[model samples]
Structures are given as structure tokens and as C-alpha cells.
Target: MQLTIWSALILYFCVFLAGLVDSAAGGGGLISLPAYLFTGLNTHTAIGCNKFSAACGTGFSAMRFFKNGALDWKIAFISAICSFISSFIGIKIAFKINPEVLKTVLIIILPVVAAALLLKKNFGVENRVEEISKAKAFRFAAYTGLAVGFYDGLMGPGTGTIAIIVFSACMKYDLKTASGNAKILNLASNYASLIVAVLNGSVIYRIAIPAAICGIMGNYLGAGLALKKGAAFIRPIMVIVICLLFAKLFYDLFARYFLGG
Candidate 1:
């Protein structure tokens, strides 16, 4: 797409916000993808560019988490490896299945998840990793990675947010730690998708490069805030991301099943 200066500014601004939200919680694609489509790029090109920027932004936040000692290296690596492999299988499955089925399921599930988070006041406030056996934690991480990664490849939205929820709820980590862990998982899937986008010659480097710079800045700052504020800061953002994902899914289902768009 040939972007005018105004369109470029708007895209960059949106990407910066996406990086901020994604680094703190997840679901930044809800913002970044729409921004790209609004700029008149086709769906494929928009996805390619968004992946390029998101991968770069996520890398910076992951590094920050590592440096801050918020990440469990063993769990992160295990999940990353599992997700990396399983995503290929998920992609294969996507070709044969109707994505609308998954979307409908998510539409029902998201609200329940959000309500649980809201009602359980102390949901992710405290890190309780010590209560769990190491073996059990690792096993759960692997399972989470496989399931979430597959969902990512199949439906391609809200993957990161789902990862965070699984890490916090199932593994009993604080929200901050869960957010940290989610970054590694996101990085694995993002780069995997990015490579395919590149091979297809879909990425527009002229646009992606500048947007990536903005994304990096946003991620850096957002990660800093999450590191400083802990679970209290991350929890609300996670809820917001979940709501955004719910809205997006509902819209897609409506457009396809009802509007015939």
C-alpha cells in the first residue's frame, strides 16, 4: 500500500499503543491489525506487517522480563519449544476446519473467563508458584503452550492474552510473572508467522521498520511499568484485553454469519 504521511502517522501511533498494551498484558493485535487495515492494506499485507512489528516489540519486552528476573527460564523455554512445534500442527488443522466454530466457542468462553477474573478479587495478586511442585508446573506450562499455540495458529487472535490467563490461573503465577512468561510464548509464534509472511513477500519493509521502532519504544515503557507495579497493574489490563478480544470475535461472527460480509 502507498501510504501518505498522514496515514503513516496514524499507523505508527496505533502500533505504539498496541505495543504498550501487548507488553503489559496481551491482545495488542486488536489495535495494530485494524490500524493496518484502516491504512488500506490488504489483509495479508496487514497481517505480515503487524507480525513484523509485534515480533520485534515482543522481543524487547521478553528481554526486559529476563533481565528483571521475572521470567522462569525453564518453564519459559519448555513452553516456547512446545508452542513452536505445535503451531505448525495448528496451521495444518486450520485448513481443514471451520474457524467460525472456534470463534463461537470463544465468544461463549471469554465472558465467563472475564467474570471469574473480576469476581475473584485476589485472582492473580500473589505469586503462588511455591505451592506447586516443579514437575507439575512444568507439565502445566507445556500443556498451556501446546493448547494456546494451536489456538493461535488456527484462529490467530488473542493468543497472547490466553497464554497469560493460562499461566496465571492454571500455573498459579502472579499476573506480572504470567505476563512475563506470555512474552516468550508470543515471541515463538510471532517469529514463526513472520518467516512465512517474509517468504510470501508480503511484508512492506518501508512501513514495518518505522512501526517497529515505535513498537519497541512502547514495549520498553510498558514493560517497565508492569515490572514496577506488579500484579495490581497487570490484572486490569488483562481484563481489558480479554474484553477487546471478546468484542472482536463477536464482530467477526456477526459479520460473517449475519451480515454476509
Candidate 2:
């Protein structure tokens, strides 16, 4: 789709900010996706275009994390493979069902995720990264990436926050390791979904390029901050972002399902 002068500028800025927020918390799509829809692109095309720029943002973040010594390559490798394959399945699931139902589910689940973070007063206090029996960690990482990756491929929100939380709190990974792994898995999902979008011919390159540049800049700053500040910073932001995103989703659902607008 062709972009107007105003829309192109806004799209670029939106992507850049999305990348920043996404790096900081995880729901960058909360901004970019709706802006795309508001600009008159269909939801499917907006989501596809989102993946295009998100891929670059995520790749940049992952590399930055790696350079800063925040990543664990062994787990990232397994997660990338599993998340990529599962993301394809998520794309298939999207076609098989109406996402309206999923939107409803988000209203409930979003609050729970938010509460989980808000309730925890001091998150990531100590580094308690366990030496997982290689097989078990791989198994858990596989499930986490596979499930979250598929959700990302299908719906396109909250993937990064979920990844960080699961890895750090649930899997007992250090904040650094979790962020590193999250960046890689997020990128993998982007690859899978971008292919899906391309196959379906939904990409809007005019917006994608500008948005991606913005996203890269935003994420670069965010990743650096994450490395320096730790998960405590990310946790609160994730809570607020999910709350806002859910509110928007609910409003969209109301408009679409009831108001017929």
C-alpha cells in the first residue's frame, strides 16, 4: 500500500517508539499495530508489515544483548528453532479461527499478566540461574518459545514480555540471560511471520522501512538500558503496556462486534 506524506512520517516515528517500548517492556505492537490499522491498512496487512520492521528491531536487540554478554547461545539456538516452527503453526491457527474470541480472552489474561508483575515488589533481586540438566532446560525453553512464538505469529503482541518473564521468573534464568534469549526468539518469530505475510502478500514496504529504522533506534537505547538497569525496570513497564493494550483491544472489540464501526 502506498503511504501519504503524513502517514509515512507518523509510521516511521511509531515504529521507532514501538521498538523502544518493545525493547523496554515487550508490547511494542501495542503502538504500531493500531496505528497501522488507523492509517487504513487492513489488520492482516498491518500485522504483516509489523513483522517486517520488528524483525530488524529484534535482530538488533539480540546482537546488542550478545555483545553486552547478556545471552546464552545454547538456549537461544534451541529456542530459535522451536519458536520458528511453532510460529508457522500459529499462522495456520490464525486462518482456522476468528480472532475475536482471542481478543475476548486477552481482557482476562492481560490483567493477570499485569498483576503478576505489579504484585512482585522486587523482581530480579539475585542471580539464581540454575544449571539445568541440558535436556530439561531445552525442553522448557522449547515449550516456552514454541507456545509464545505461535501466539506472536498469529496475533502479534506481548511476545517479548512473556518471553522475559517465563525465562527469568519461571525458568530461573538471570535477567540478562532471559533478555538475550527473548531477543533471539522474538526475531525468530518475526522471520516466520514475515514469511507468512509475504506468502499472503500483506507487507507494506513504504511503512515497513521507516518504522523499522525508528524501531532500531528505540530498541538500541532500550537494550542498553536493560543491560544496565535490569528486569526491575522492564517489569513495571510491561505491566502498564499490557494494561493499555488490553484496554485498546477491548475498545476495538466493542467497536467491531457491537458498534459495527
Candidate 3:
């Protein structure tokens, strides 16, 4: 499968954009995967390569967050393991079902989430430091990991955003820390999914390599910006990512129903 130079350029450009947005907010796969498919690869291969690039991007951001002391190791580690295991299971389930059902539901929910964010001006801005028991925090982290990880494997978007929201609302963390934690957990899911894709021979390393390089740079820069700017930077990007996810879902629905693809 030889890719034309134009296709390679387009894929690199798309992955670069996806990485930047995903590092700052989440939902980068919303762009990266579609870009892969646009290159005319089979869905499985596209998904596999998407995981490759996405994982690299997330891993870079996670490291930056860790270096900056934004992560809670206990929460991040537990969630990472759970995300990996659950994502593996989710991928298995996804193979058996029609993803359109999930897409339709997301299309409905994304707007509601965006509206909620818009309505609450200071939603992800400040850390509402509530002293909860260690046991409870662990439980919350585990539950969030399993649920969002499952979603990531099954549908492959918004997992990080969901994790960030859970951290902010449930764990009482600030948006910056929440974003950092989300990046680590999200990497686990991407790794699990990428492993599956590799075993199934779904990844195209030729394309994935270049895209991953672009993704790494984007993640590095985006994470740095997030650390510097805080939620003031991440909030609007998160909203925009949600809206893009909505648009992607809408397009998919139209393709499936209207075009009968």
C-alpha cells in the first residue's frame, strides 16, 4: 500500500493538529482517525495507526505533566492499569457491535456537556480542594478509569475529557492536574488498543512513524502551554474539541444513514 506524497502530507498535518488539541484538552483521535481513513486504508488499519500516533502524543504530555508535578501518582497509576484492562475488553466488544449506536448517543451528549461547560464559567478553573478519604478517592479513580477506558476502547473519543471532568468534580482537583492525570490514563487505553491493533496487523508503520513524530512535538508544545496557562487555556479548547467530536459523529451518521455506507 504505497501512499502518495499528498496523502502523507495530509495525514501528517491532520495528526499534528490532533496532537495539539488532544494534549491540551482530549479528543485528538476525533481528527487523527478520520484522517487515517481518508488515506483509504481499511478501518482496522486506520484505527491501529491512529492508536499508534495518539499513544505517542498522550505519552509525551503525560511525561510533561509528571515532570511538572501535576499528577497524583496513586490515582494516575491505578487508573492507568484499569484503563488498559478495560480498554482491551472494550475493543473486543466494539468488534461485535454497530458503533453507530454509540455515535448517536455521543452526538446527543456532547452538546449537553458543551452547554454545561459554557454555563459554568469557573467549572474547570479552580481547585475545589475537598478532603476525602484515601479509600474513597481510590474508588473514584478506579471507577472512572474502568468506565472511561471502556468508552475509549469501544468508541475512541472523549475519554480524556471525561477523565478530566471526573477528576475535577469527583476528586476535587484543579483542571491542570486533572488534565495531567487524564493524559496518563488515556495513554494506557491507547497502548492497550495499539497492542490489539498490532496483534491483528492493523497498523501501518510507514504512516504511523511520521505521524507519531508530529504528534510528539504537538503534545510537547501543547502540554507546556497548558501548564503555563491553566484552565483558561484548556477550557475553550475542551469545548471546541467536544464540538468537533459532535461534528464528526454527525458526519458519520450522515454517511451511514444518508449515503448508506
Off by over 4 Å in 3: 259-261
* Cα-lDDT of candidate 2: 0.81
Alpha-carbon lDDT, every model: 0.90, 0.81, 0.88
Going through the candidates in order, what is the number of backbone clashes in each? 0, 2, 0
Best by lDDT: 1
lDDT of 2 by residue, 218-241 (tens): 889888888888776777777778
Ten contiguous residues with the weakest lDDT in model 2: 123-132
Candidate 3 or 2, higher TM-score:
3
Query: The CA-based lDDT of model 3 is what?
Result: 0.88
* Candidates by TM-score, descending order: 1, 3, 2
Q: Show the lowest summed lDDT stretch of 10 residues, model 1.
A: 252-261
After TM-score superposition, the amount by which residue 130's alpha carbon in candidate 3 deviates from its true location, in angstroms, is 3.3
TM-score of 3: 0.94
List, residue by residue over 212-249, the lDDT tens digit for candidate 1: 99999999999999999987888788889999999998
Who is ahead in lDDT, 1 or 3?
Answer: 1
Candidates 1 and 2 compared by lDDT, better number? 1
